[model samples]
Target: MGLLVPVSVMAAPPSVGSVSISPDPAYTDTPLTATPSEDWYDEDGDPEGYVWRWQKYSTGISDWEDIADQTDNTLDSLYFIAGDQIKVICTPFDGVESGVDVEATITISNSLPTITGVTIAPDPASTASTLKATPQGWYDADGDLEGYVWRWQKYNTGILDWEDIADETDNTLDSSNFVLNDQIKVICTPFDGTDEGVPVEAVIVISVLDYSGSIDVKPGSDENPINLGSNGVIAVVIYTTDGFDATTVDVSTVKFGPSEAAPVHYAYEDVDEDGDTDLVLHFRTQEAGISAYDTSVTLTGETDSGTAFTGTDTIKIVPSKAKESVQGNEDAPGQNKEPGESATGKAIGKESAPGQNKEPGESATGKGKNK
Candidate 1:
């Protein structure tokens, strides 16, 4: 042997044989733990400890990204979702150097989401207002919330049962589709990209909105006198106030007085001198059915948006001149005449001198006073 001398052999660095992730088909609801195989070999002895590195593959960037602050052996369920690729690398560490890296990966499976609450607004739904549905307490273990699926239903009075509204799938329902006293319902279903969750529902009854407005009878006249016997049209003005708009009133639906007479004509003007536009409508006086004894008048109508409105005002029913003329003619015959005067206000039978007594037949010159 060529100079056989005693030589010391150096031990190889620690080497990791294999690493595995528990629950191979990982789910979003469960935590994932990494385990290293005991088959790790080192000529010097067992390795001191292990070093772990976690990474997630991003489909958007098409690359592997290291997860920060995830050096631990366990990854919480909050970190991953369905279809996510999780990988963990384990390396055996000796006193001097770190050995070869071994890794294990698992694909996260889909999990169902849960919808805990559903509500509709505004709380008191009205025919003049739009109703909107809102989903609350949405829970998804996978941290993926795509959107919601909405379905609308109405309780059909004709059928006496709930029926689905055709093509009313939006979260917001317009007032035009429903009327007063209609029962409306909205169902909300939450879903991820892959699966849908449990559904929740909310319901409300449609009500008619009541709006109070100021109305002026006869436009400029504060007394608002009405002649029941007149054959002309009566004018009424609906004022636009801070809380109500007169222009929104439907002309065809306007009714005035106790007779509920419809408007024959309408126009827009600033009747109250408030600089705001007002609605003026005309109804037939005879058709209004306002009596001379009536002290007040009321106007009722619906808005263009289906809101109901009512207004009342004091009125003084004035006597008609035609009736006064008839009364004057009836009194002209014999009533209110002086003594011994004819219907024409002259002395009866003959012209009598002053202080002369008249017999049964008085002469014209009073010469035959007792003849």
Candidate 2:
């Protein structure tokens, strides 16, 4: 029968729903994956095979160019550069095309990260000063401003190498150990969890103030003791380092011996006349009798804008003795009598005793015994 030979017709081409892409926000020189939705179907209920094709939209040519072709349901190992556009097409067939061709397109937008304007505070630094670091004008495609990492480094004196400072992270640095003529620098870089951007750096040279000096007790030595009267005064002179200014020294820090002795008076002088001021401190002796006593002196403070200095010395104190006088005349030995004494060792006005003569020229006090 002619009615039994019915003809079988092919179905429409395959149709797919919206496409999905992993890592929607891509960065420079990175990978991206595109997946088709499960809503894809063919008019023939099922297709023998599925085809996936990828193409890149070229702005220069104002057209799309084929990039890859495969029979799988998904595509991978696709790298997109900055500002690149991608497109994917899917088709299903079972001896005949079914439904319409499914297509999806995505624009790849990626930019590189940048860091700039790394800075340090307090250009001239010291060991006692706190140095600060400041960075500016840094941004990335991810729009993360505070995602920057920091590190500090120091340059060896006279050496062409740099050393990384341990535990010196963030935007601050511990300049406590920095010495004169030391060179220091800081580096800042941007991090977006998966990648690191370019690095920016800044450097500064350090200058430290020195206040090294010594203290000296006058009229005293390591072996010899100082001689002072009952009420004597002690004199102390302090010598500072070549570049230190002694005039700004704080005299209150000068201590005499274990007991803190307040200086009776203090002055500055150019003892060596080298055009720099040196310190001089005067201290009144204690009521203790001077009999070879030990005196420890120390100077613990100096300078106003520089580092303070410390000096100490040990000294001895001795008492002064008066001279003894003899109660005798110039012509007599161990006696004070008038000139021309009698030979019998009696005064001229005294009466003669026993057989002794009482004459002024024949007295025992005379220049010589009577001939």
Candidate 3:
């Protein structure tokens, strides 16, 4: 015997028996925690500091990739997809040589789901108009889209906040309640047998049309242009029928004819004392040079939303007078005598001279007796 010497052999690697992965049939893009069985052991009974290496094999690339490596006995699953295979191995070292890798595998049976795109048929939707939410490009890891729910919401400007559409749960919205520059958002969520998944969201803007108010010409408005007196005050009453605040009417949009005029005096009050507020505006007709004999008094204005409103009334002007009067029936050279009887009961072509009385049917050319 050639000096028979007993040599010490290095212990074998630790066997990480079975890998228990919570949610084995995990959904794609969802996290799953993997825990190795406690039956793992090193032949030398020194498994401390054993290295755990996790690897993944993707069907898309047909290759194995090293995902993570640590001393811990657990693996945090991330970004796994259907037909993807994952494995964890433990290597134990006996101070000098490394042992074999004892491994276990877990295959992903499901994939991730997603809502790729969303749209509105008429993106800039109008108030009281139908708005339909069209969801496009959806993917279900499980290849099913039967259990999906949706909700719509609007950004409110009054309180400067978002308001949920309580009564709307369908994919199509009818008679949308939108204001100018309204931001609308929608959310879609997945549900599977009473289990709810994460939700996806999309946003769109609603362009509402501006509001236009109806107008009316107040009573006593002259069909003919009435002469403007020295004061030149022309009173106007605006009947606001729009949904906008009349008190906040845009002064720039308020115009008389083609001329612009600042409100000399304006108030939304009960001018007629009828207990109802009326928009009253005063314009200096003379100052605006709108005292033409015949002119159209065009009242034009707009709301804060830039909607146009207009009212027009025709009028005619005349010479200024303290009071209207009837023509006199006095006689004069080359002046035709009054065709009708005078107020004093004198017939036509007959008039009394000063301090004289004329008989009925007597010509004024004839000498009449003095009264």
Query: Candidate 1 at 81: error in angstroms?
Result: 8.2
Every candidate's CA RMSD? 21.3, 22.5, 18.8
Question: lDDT by residue for model 2 over 115-166, one digit each (tens)?
Answer: 7778888765554457788777767654544566888888975578898888
lDDT of 1 at 200: 90
* Stretches of model 2 off by over 4 angstroms after superposition: 1-3, 47-49, 68-79, 111-124, 127-207, 210-371
TM-score for candidate 2: 0.38
lDDT of model 3 at residue 106?
Answer: 76
TM-score of each: 0.40, 0.38, 0.35
Candidate 1 global TM-score: 0.40
Q: How many steric clashes does model 1 contain?
A: 0
lDDT of each: 0.71, 0.55, 0.53
lDDT of 3 by residue, 269-364 (tens): 432223335465656655545645446566767667665555566555545672122111222111111222221223211333221123355443
* Model 1, position 270: C-alpha lDDT score: 53
Measured on C-alpha atoms, candidate 2 has an lDDT of 0.55
Worst 10 residues of 2 by lDDT: 323-332
Strongest candidate by TM-score: 1
lDDT of 1 by residue, 310-358 (tens): 6777777777875333212222112122223333222211232221222
How far out, in Å, is residue 222 in model 1?
Answer: 15
